[model samples]
Target: MASTSAPARHVPGFSAPAVGFEEPFAMLEACHERVQRTLALLDRLREHVRQQGADESARQAARDVLRYFDVAAPLHHEDEELHVFPLLLAQAAPEMRTLVQRLQQDHVDMVADWAAARVPLQALAQGEIEGFSESAEALFDRFAARYASHIHHEERQAYPAALHLLEPALLGRMGQEMAHRRGAPER
Candidate 1:
């Protein structure tokens, strides 16, 4: 008899969670989890409109997506910019500099893409529109792809490099600042 296993699923945001803000890297990972979850929700929204039209579920999904990207995503980016990037820029090897620059540019592009998606998404959330434009859908795809790639790069290279570059004191400070930024109690 041949052994069989369950088919692998590609759920984007269901990875292991970050312990808390006390561990800054863990918190960043947690933020990425939420980003994945929210992006998945956006995909569901598209499907919902296709299958069910602009119903209550779609509205709620839109609302959830807006809340996350508007509030959490910016903070996540800020956390990286404030605590992670500077250290890397100053300390990482020469080869990493270009990668860091590209990541920074990604941040800029993400912000712009979010703004473009937001207009249509906000309307959808408010029940002002029953469907999204083709441009909005394309923007969402681009946004998701950019995030997926950005997260991949950070996890694969930048973050691990940061773990080595930053000292204990700096890591502590990063955790504290991250906690305070989120209004989470310092751990």
Candidate 2:
């Protein structure tokens, strides 16, 4: 029998029927919102796996996870690496280069975590994510753990560095660049 009880699901970070922008911070803030929503969905997916209901949900959450892994995550990384990091690296004290490397390492590590998840997640969406051998629960757990820590580290360490290092002029250029990247017309 199909369960009648609606599972208590976490709310997604975005809810309105529209998307809006308020200028420079909009792209960054939207990325933040995307990560939050995707994390919430990831948490729910983990919960479903814990209940051994991956088969039940058919990994419906995979769609959202895949979208995040492919789009939002990569764009944020690109913005940091190509735009923010280079600006910081150009003028940061020599002593701080190591911090930059460590932050970049965090991005690399998170990419690896996503790499590890892709095949199994793809398979899962194919109606048999693991062929009865792979532990779907284990897979989801590892992905969640790696990604959650990555986000926390950036929020705590990397973002502050960018904020500190970017000059007002560079920041304006960055705002324009990011806006262009997101398809906003010249302002």
Candidate 3:
């Protein structure tokens, strides 16, 4: 018998993710979309756990959430730290500097919390039913609160600063770099 690799599947009308100097808005939008996706999954996982129906598929879904948390979420945060936040700091007044600094502190705090959070998520993924649901729900609440606050901070503070400080040309460049760094398709 001959073995053959299957052809790649494509969703109809789907293009590669947008990528280029034109994509900062889209890049930010994609991160927010991922946040929404994880939040929905978290809600479903909690529901499954409540009903005591968190079987193998539930466990696998739990694992998928963790994978995105580990990979995409942290990278997004790092991108802000390296690119977005520093640019704000460089141009903000002394009074405004403290808020940017606080945002930076939030990033550190978030990363630390992430390290602790993995324990509960792993427990969920492994189907450790004893306290997994309660622990996970609590962790998820904290994570959600932190994220809600963080994104709000960006919206109210950092994003405004970026828009104010960066020229149209620089913003365009930043957008391009962000899209490429995120591996959204090459354009």
- Could you report the Cα RMSD, in angstroms, for every candidate shown? 8.6, 7.6, 6.3
List the candidate numbers ranked by TM-score, top first.
1, 3, 2
lDDT to native, each model: 0.82, 0.61, 0.67
List ranges where model 2 is wrong by over 4 Å.
1-26, 50-52, 55-57, 130-139
Point out the worst 10-residue segment of candidate 2 by lDDT: 1-10
TM-score of 2: 0.71
What TM-score do all the candidates reach, one by one? 0.89, 0.71, 0.78
Ranking by lDDT: 1, 3, 2
Pairs that collide in candidate 1 are none
Model 1 alpha-carbon drift over 4 Å, by segment: 1-18
Model 2 lDDT tens row, 1-187? 0011113322223232243333344455556667767767766765666567557474677666775677557766777788756755776776556767776887887787777776666665666653323465566566667656766665666566677876678778877775455454566
lDDT of 2 at 55: 72
> How many clashes in each candidate?
0, 2, 2
Query: Could you tell me the lDDT of residue 32 within candidate 3?
Result: 58
Best by TM-score: 1
